[model samples]
Target chain A: MGSSIAANQLVWHHDLTGQVLDPASLNLFWFELTEGAYGQIHRVKAIVEIVDGSAWQLSFNQGEDPMETELPVERWLSGRPDRPSQIEVVAGVDFDPIGVTAACRVAGSPMRYYSIIKPSCGSSHENRGYFLYSWQL
Target chain B: MKIAVISCIHGNYEALNAVLSDIDDHKVEQIYCLGDLVGYGPHPNAVVEMVRSLNIPTVQGCWDEDIIEGLNACECSYPSILAEQRGKLAHTWTDQEIHPETREFLAQLPMTLRVDNLAFVHGSPNNQHEYLLPEIDAFTAMERVLGTGADVLFCGHTHVPYVRDLSDGLVKVQVKRSGVSETATQIHVAPLKRIINAGSVGEPRHGRPNATYVIYDPESAEVKLREVEYDYPKTCAAIIDKGLPAIFAWRLARGLEYAERAEDPTHICER
Candidate 1:
């Protein structure tokens, strides 16, 4: 099990890519990190922006256990019924021995990223990837 | 023999009654309606029963589809939404306001009608939602006519009367700028592909608040757009007494074009 950190608690460490992102990008890094004897888990917050400027938030938790070592991720883009563009993950999670990778790829292009989390479990485990985001004007 | 094409009655029983009375003198052989028998105006069942009694050949319109179906069944403009809501509200009146048989008839009406070489529809042949207004360009008009294989296409959704001829390697849009006057003007139809909007019988949009209809002669190939003044006060009173929306009555007083004016960006006031 995992828990996401508050937006105020997350520190904007580095851009890493030096790409210009929106001020609202701060919400991307809000995640919680927990470590246990077996492995580490990360809980990420999902944010959705509707065409009417309405925002919806969902919580997704990723846990690492002996039976399962990955978390789920979903992303979507553009909520307009006339024109819809979305990105989502059906199964699996992203796992890295040193850090957890959460990337949002929209319309064949990557736009946002979440801070990486290193699992304290071990280096032999495989990482799972999942994310979703949707935007509309 | 003179034939009248009336459409978009929109349940305005008073205006429809007045127009029917005026046309009774013409001795018309047949009266054909181009759909939209109910919407915006007040009496749905009354208008439906009146049209049914006439035994006129009618077509289905977008408004009719919405009332019988639902709003999401088709796309619509903002004013169309208002008109549809008013129609839904009118359902609260007497049960005789909208008979089940009338609804069945409206649902069963065809989208297109072929009377000899003349084609009839609620809007354009290409799309029932489109409005073939007089102000539109000739090329666009030609596209609409070409989409249908009829020599003459009669339509009535924009509530404006005009003729478009697309033959002899030339396209022309003949617009009736004024309503029927003391001296009646005759429209000569050539042997070519043409699109004609018979305008509205109950509600006219062209400056003139009078009810409009067209008399089409197949033999002489002539089409005459005629307008007759009705008792607006009686129509307004009926609408108000029926508890219909105020915009319906207000628009009749001004005769302000709704469909065309809404499309113009400069005419934001209408929006």
Candidate 2:
């Protein structure tokens, strides 16, 4: 009810296509947004890790002319085969769901779907362990 | 009136009998069976026969649909290969052993039932295979109930019972389209809509062997989760005697889930 994320709460706000995630992006790391029992949201901090591929990248578009942002080292030494890149964090995606990109509003907005809070996820079944680059608010 | 809802009996006649008796004792005016009358238990025929004879209003569960339409499990239905194999063994057995009339009953059962302001389904309104877990995403959860157009939705399949309230909220979405004007959609969820899971009567996985069901009072909008102790050991024995996997019995005695995928809260069933 308040604007503060409660203890043990994780939240995510994303508005993209089919939901705009590239199949080549490998593991979107969903647990970062859906752990904890509180389901509240004060802030979001995350790190995107490149688990595989020489050209580790994050793409916003997927059509013919795509906007691809390549990680520095992962691209420089790409296709070496001997060097498989696995850069963690800003090198990848610290999932700031409510990042600067959104045409977004939280408290002041008349409607709020900013984050889908999963309030009943404290059980062992839902806990798939933290498998990411960053998860500190 | 006090209404009793039972789900996922899974062919355990003993647990079903006990829970039915408990419902009788509670003096419920109406009873609802949220399908899964067969599968992974000792007495599919007897269980189906009893429910049929009792004339309980039931909605088709995922297992119920599977017996009629063949196995249509979605992602994470079996967490591991061992679990999948075990699930298939049970499925094959249920498919072969299920009586034609019983299968027919399951086929005739509606995927959803609406009574006054309450709607009932074996899983989510979307599909019987979809799990309306207590921790399911708030947006998806609200959408499920809204789709039902009901004040409350009763569902089961997770084998663990719980309730969630979706009340007084704004659902905003900014849709991204290709070569078109950007549009935003909003739905105002007001008052309250509830999702009540009746848990499992036969193969409970909430860390106990007691059969669970739900008693809801439509007038007061109150819900009472009923866990009734039955002769589960007899059901366990019958599981082994009837040639079901022995692990099913072992897990039944402990109320541990056997081969059923009850984990993965974020999994939204594609089916």
For every model in order, what is the number of clashing pairs?
27, 7
Among residues 3 or more apart in sequence or in different chains, the pairs in candidate 2 whose N, CA or C atoms overlap within 3 Å are A5-A42, A17-A20, A46-A94, A47-A93, A47-A94, A48-A93, A48-A94
The DockQ-based CAPRI class assigned to model 1 is incorrect
Candidate 1 per-residue C-alpha lDDT over B1-271 given as tens digits, one digit per residue, 9 for 90 to 100: 7788888777767767777876687777888899888765667878888888888899998677766765432102322222223344543442336678878888898888887777898887755556787667766666566556678889988887877676753444454556744554543334467877888876778877787888888788788887878777676677778766444565576564322222221111111
lDDT of 2 by residue, A50-111 (tens): 21322334332112231334456542222113333221111113334332222111101110
The weakest ten consecutive residues by lDDT in model 2 chain A span A105-114
- DockQ of the candidate models in sequence: 0.01, 0.02
Q: iRMS for all predictions?
A: 26.6, 17.9
What TM-score is obtained for chain B in each of the predicted models?
0.79, 0.94
For each of the candidates, the C-alpha root-mean-square deviation to the true structure, in angstroms, is 21.5, 17.1
Highest lDDT against the true fold, candidate: 2
DockQ, Cα level, model 1: 0.01
What would the per-residue lDDT of candidate 2 be over residues B1-271, giving only the tens digit for each residue? Answer: 8999999999999999999999999999999989898889979999999999989999998888888888654324644323545677798999889888988988999999999999999988888877888877888888888888898999999999998988884566567678878665665645788899999998899989999999999999889999999999899889889888765786788787665473564454444
